[model samples]
Target: MLEDLKARNPHIAIYPVSDARFSKYGKVLDGFDFNQCLDIMQTRPIPEEGNCYVASDAELMGTDVAGELSRRFYAGMPVQIGYCNGNSSKLNALEYHKGSEVDVAVTDLVLLLSDIRNISHNELSSESVEAFFLPANTACELYATTLHFAPCKTSSDGYKSIIVLPAGTNAGLDSIPAPKCEEDYLLWMQNKWLIAHAESIPASKGAFVGITGDNIEINY
Candidate 1:
């Protein structure tokens, strides 16, 4: 399936986490016990077609890993535990926040990434996007400048990963002050400024839809 994907999208190349390009943005976490988090994921139901779950702050009352992450990685910055599990392939949108995000891959998956600095006028060229392969049972920190969204499944079983971020990263944005500029169009959610491809589902939901180029889809 990977070979087929490459054949169709020459620009799309999946790199291992150890690649130097990844070093500039994130790193793999060694010696972390992800069993407890994976156990909780096994209890939830992941979607078959697209990303379906996201708890912006599951750590508040969810798992012990959250506290561990805060103390060890977040410097006690009141982190939150969340999860994104689904069977998705398209690069629908790209979003970023004020700080780094840690992702524990309970299952093998592919993450689409791009440097937020490449975006201009609230729009980003798809040509700048890249794909990175995240192996199962590994955790990595994605820096704030990295634009990313859901993990694409590498197989039919689908993908499941634990997401760690600052508290209230994805909370409701109904109370945010009104948009004042073009960049504000990307503020669909709190702490998340998004640029969605026109063909993406979020575009229909009134997302900024500032991404230009084909809506990338990974072959499974």
Candidate 2:
């Protein structure tokens, strides 16, 4: 059942989730016309986790031909296809401070060399993996496990550095010093509930590049 989630490589194109109905800060527009834009891919969490820790300098995960990572215990890391395309909008600027106490992150882009060590996760084993987002060419990071806002669109060439946090049981993050969302963040918060799920498919069809092994070297 898990293996069926993947599609052929050629058909895969990471699409920008332009949710016109939902608010950018992840609030449901009551009585607004809402239709989940299908035909892209359905982001399913292979070894999905709602709440988990994010170690500093984490990279978005990918897969090998043998398909072992997604099939094994290491498959549930972030997926880095490329950088976030069309890179500039107020919403595009998901800021990251040096050190913060939080959990959960979803990446808009892969982390570059610099911000890699500057960031960190709670390292929660069997805990709610945080979701996060890091931006390209910028020197910042979102608070780990802090639900600032997300669904950042990746560029055709992919982004250089971006980071998110593991999911946690914090309700809406009003207490913590949450990261600041760009002015119009509510627009992209189309599928907040769905985004929290570990094993959601990307909407349409594409290659499922999941983690393969412990070695982070791209043999491809």
TM-score for each prediction? 0.90, 0.19
Candidate 1 per-residue lDDT over residues 21-115, each given as its tens digit = 89866888885677888777777677756677676535323577777877888788887777888988889999999899989888888889999
- Taken over the whole model, the C-alpha lDDT of each candidate is 0.82, 0.22
**Cα distance off (Å), candidate 1, residue 78:** 1.5
* Candidate 2, 66-114: lDDT as tens digits: 1232233124632222112222211211222222321111223421111
State the displacement of the C-alpha of residue 170, model 1, in Å, after optimal TM-score superposition: 0.8
Candidate 1 to truth, TM: 0.90
List ranges where model 1 is wrong by over 4 Å: 1-11, 56-62
